[model samples]
Target: MSVTAPAPKRIELSLPALHPEQERILRESSRFNVIRAGRRFGKSTLGRHVLMNAALQMAPVAWVAPTYKRLTPQWREICATLNPVIARRSEEEKHIDLIGHGGEIDFWSCDGGGFPGEGRKYKLIVCDEVAMLGSDLERIWTRSLRPCLTDLQGGAWFLSTSKAASSYFTQMYSWGQGERPEWKSWQMRTADNPYILPSEIAAAKQDLPAAAFLQEFEGDAVSFSGSVFTNLEQAIVDAPLPEQYERWAQQRSWMAPETEFFIGCDWAGAGRRAGGDFTAFVTMAKDGTICAIERFKADFALQRVRLAGLVSRFRPAAVLAEENSIGAPMLSALRASGISVQGWTATNATKHKAVEALALGFEEGRVKIYDVENRAVLLAELMSFEATSLPNGMTRFAAPSGGHDDLVVACFLAYLASHRPRVGECAWSPI
Candidate 1:
């Protein structure tokens, strides 16, 4: 009897050609590698290659993200790239077994609201988008994933786009590049990607807000001035409004004809990307009192539905929304849905005007903010807002890098819409 030997471990895999930076990362000998790269720099692709290589070497691996929803695309990419080598797969558990190798790859979320994969040991671990993983990252790594690597003397990889200089990702990168003998790091920009176009990067540089452009394209950890709204004080901001003020303001029947409420929205895009910008809405009374402020991290369609619901409930006098890329189309969609929303183009001049108007209201103690939580958010953003003068005499107003000004923007638009000059009202009149 002749027993045929098991077919030689035949492996066939195809991936996009790696750029020089990716090749350098792959060739590095560091047990712990950190990549601080701008968005669209092919970090994910490199991460997949790292994880797959470890698996083929007969090591157990786990690819983790902040949440499972965010991990879906990576899982798809892995399956598509390794179809021939995958012996079996489990979608529910996000696990895959490689043919002829006693190896497996498990895709998991850090599972922030629930338990992360705690007890299982892994030879390789990849944490993608590490900066956006929030403040729980240290705990997740130290208390959970770290122990899993002890048995195998395994390696780990961290990948993220730049957020803030104060962010934990930056902190880790700093340590890895200095004190840690086991760790090493690489920093690159989106423009470094051979697949991306220089014109595209230039357009992004011109189109995005300065802070955002620096963080998203240049991979800079930016830090700037203190809060822009100097007049913000607890005495004025935390003052209590009437009983059930928010409910009364949100319900249309309780509104008086003369009591105009304006809504300002900073819409997110069509939800094409994960962890994208949030859509924020601030509702204000004509007298400059904040009634309600809501922020949603959703796509354009869902945000429009939400806006329509708000319009029906509040019967706002005017809806002032950003009229830039996503905003213009969103305004059209809302109009098509029978909601009358006005679009305001965001430029240096318009932004300064609106922000200054809001600041003046705060200074005059005319802006009454309600709800302690919402008040905190608005106050935080306002405090972080900055106005810097360029060499050419142009002043730029924006939030700090990696920080959001959505609530502040919404507030400014709402303030602008409600405080417009009356027929005989003077531009210099008291706010």
Candidate 2:
């Protein structure tokens, strides 16, 4: 770890010295500023300056994070910087009233789909680590947060290191590059910060994968490089299928009473790993259209009940599950509950074959799925699906590190179940 200079005995409400890149963007004249900066590029420091300037002028401003936990340090620093001017403070609500300047700064989190900032207005809003909001970032910004700024004719600062499946942040960055007016963007790399040693960045380059380093250290807005399934978007049907063949009434609801559907079950561990993923259920039609997708976390009893319900609803022609570790027992239990379930042991060859069939469906324009709000989870997993080639001439399939692929596995299993039918162990054939 890099060492830091000790804090002085006295506290002062002065901005820290900024490196050239930070200093440059700090003076930008733009209404909407999107900044993509690598780790340790002094983004927080520059944000402090911006907030201080706004508060000093008595401008109403707020700081937002994807989650509340990340706001603690920012809250402390902002409070300390403006302590002498703070007329009142609310520790519970995380808001402050400035005395000398009459400015007010409110701290909020977008943890609940952009509801925290509802019915409020701000002259300027700072969104830190906006990318961590994931695919919902656009929905939050456009549907909710953007309106908050309109009342005050205000601006926003969207800042982050690349951290999402979508290129929304990158699109904003492009807008700053002469694509649109009233916007400016900057890309700052860790090496640009004089304080971060070159050796540290070099070490990071070796430690992280190329794509991850570009995002985390270089601030490059990169999409996935090794996505196993290409053309996932082409298969997305944004509207609900017509009710003539649909079973449910609600938007994106799963219902196909007149047709055959397959259920794919990707079981989760029975408290095997800390923070393990959910057991994913993918219901797919024989024509490569997904009917419904459900995912949840529970013990064997709860899982059985959930599966039994789905089994009763669709009466799926076949139920295919991953047969490894807990999968075997779960399949047996599901059968004991009178749900006929088949198990497929996932070997590298078997996975390759199954995934290839799914990929071909996309290429052939045969795979189609509903674009539901909850379906974003599955789409994200599919988008970030990675395939790394091994020395043995085989490809490994999984999601990026710090992500879950249970949905993707279940999806392929559902796809496989539609085309390939086996009595016992799952055997693959080209669809």
Candidate 3:
């Protein structure tokens, strides 16, 4: 009698239900897929499900993000799906192996001055938020991960909302739009997702500057030429204002006995209703998170009263106000009210250095800001601000003609106060 052989068990694999827009992209047979979608469009959910489906093909796949911190949440979701089929999990390496010859999954970051997953082959690559990868965008693709796909003739998917219109991501998008037959691209807005509220998007359009509204909510990569900031999407968070934690801080202050917050003020010299300049006050956490912003055109007395209200609410340790022109009177007023206020004078050189520092704060991911309604003006000013190199080798930073930088200066002072050096980096010295 001959012995019978058992067949391999069939492992059922199904993709999570996708919205029509997401499903449409996967239906294509293109070797490269690029998607530009607005915030809250469920790009992560779509990416997670697609990667899970790809795992069934028995070939290694990689997921890359701008930073490891941003990759954590998505990694958690992917791990949960692979848990049932996991053969092994390496938390330190962030790799997952499947039991049914489902190959493996790896996660990597584009930062730290190296190509992610160098010398590793993959059957598929997913680069999320390609726009945030910064100046390394060209080198990362041409010299690194793109070559790793040759062994298996693997495919890639790139996704981002677009930062600069001239960004390298834009070049890849052009390739998808008939420049390269092997590539395909699609653009979707917040409204594309049936789940997002139309009212919310409409409100954002009203609040955000025109260019910002287009890029962030409509998936258009509008160029903010010479803008002092990069990676605004990463810096602007949805955290609650400091006032929300007022009670908690009050209770905890007795235990820690340390300062929790600081404030930076830029005076507009009673420009309210006169249309000359606007005043800006920024309340910043000790760690550089901009907890709240108050921008208005008000007289000196009213401004102090408002500033005092903020001081009482957050109980900031100090208020650093610009110590020139109208700023002098504002500082004196706040000081007279028993508020701990300091005055910092801004020369062109010092101001430029401070602005540069704030820019770096955004680039290095050291800064975060609350995305409140009043924040739109500040974002607009930062994005539209220009940088000019002077003959003396000093860089000149200023807002576009007829635009306002009151908030930008306030933010610079806040960042300067937050990162004030006790020993190193005295270029940001405030007098």
Candidate 4:
């Protein structure tokens, strides 16, 4: 009896095709590979292709994003291509047990509970939209996911767009820039995706804002519009101070001082419920260098105590508190505490002017900071700053929606009020 020929082995593979960048990222075998590109540039598509291949090889892969909603669309795309049978299954049957047996893909968001439980370990973990993940999630990734891969001889693949230059994705980019023992990077723009239609790209460029076009389509690190301090890297220094260095912080007391100092304040009212702005206190030396900076939320007694503490700690020459709702009360409180304080009102002077002055200091390399924390907050706020004009023919400087500018506003006020030579004044005036 002739035996029927065994049915041809079924090879299940899910991927349209591999592009050059995808090939490089997949074949490198590095411990880390950062895939940075613009939106709709096939970043997720390439990520799915690599993950599916790894899973087919019996490598347990984990896919994650900032949230479940962000990962769902790509999860559906991957499911349709890799496991049509599973995809067609009813939602009730989509549980992990049913999918795991069929070599199906499992997706999750970067929430507290999304991490794998005790039983299973992932061989490869792919993090998408990495920029949006919180710092706590990053800690989980390094502490949990990285170690799991060690036993499986696997690596992680990071896929994301170029978010803010100070975001987690940028941090990864910085790490990849160095020669790591096991890591690599692959960057590309929307133009790199051959499959994307040119007409579509042109349409996007026409419809999107200039900043959005550069960041999402061209993959350029363009700064946000109307930023008060555009060049923060130049304004802030990260170098360590010399052991023998001596300056303002050393020979200063809050009681009184021979050298004059200017106090810059950004007052916030309506208490914490208002969520409008912060109460900031900044003390700058006459030479334009920052001596002391203090920031706190909108609290009456707490802010007063903090301001009093600052005055008693570093005797400022004059306090310039913003003349907003809280300014009057704050000034009164400082006065009651025996602190020298004054109210400074922001006038028709455009936000651009103040920012330009700060930018000039940065360009001249005159701006310096004693601590890095305030500098970081200031940089972030500077990046988010924007200019807007009111209906009454007045322009104002403000932070972008959902942005923080407490430190920046304080810094700007300090820069504006700090002592500067008159436009035509000379150091050696003729008697």
Off by over 4 Å in 1: 1-9, 113-115, 224-411, 414-431
**Candidate 4: deviation at residue 355, Å?**
16
Clashes of 2: 1
| Model 2 C-alpha lDDT per residue in residues 224-278, reported as the tens digit of each score | 3465566778888989754533453122233443266788988777222434679
lDDT of 1 at 203: 84
By TM-score, highest first, what's the ranking?
A: 3, 1, 2, 4
Prediction 2 global C-alpha lDDT? 0.76
Which pairs of residues collide in model 4? 253-315, 254-314, 254-315
Total clashes for model 3: 0
Q: Write the per-residue lDDT of candidate 1 for residues 336-358, one digit (tens) a residue.
A: 76777777988888986787677
Clashes of each: 1, 1, 0, 3
Local distance difference test scores for all models: 0.76, 0.76, 0.74, 0.61
> Compared to the true structure, candidate 4 yields what TM-score?
0.50
What TM value does model 3 have? 0.58
Return whichever of 1 and 4 wins on lDDT.
Answer: 1
Pick by TM-score: 2 or 4, better one: 2
Model 3: worst 10 consecutive residues (lDDT sum): 422-431
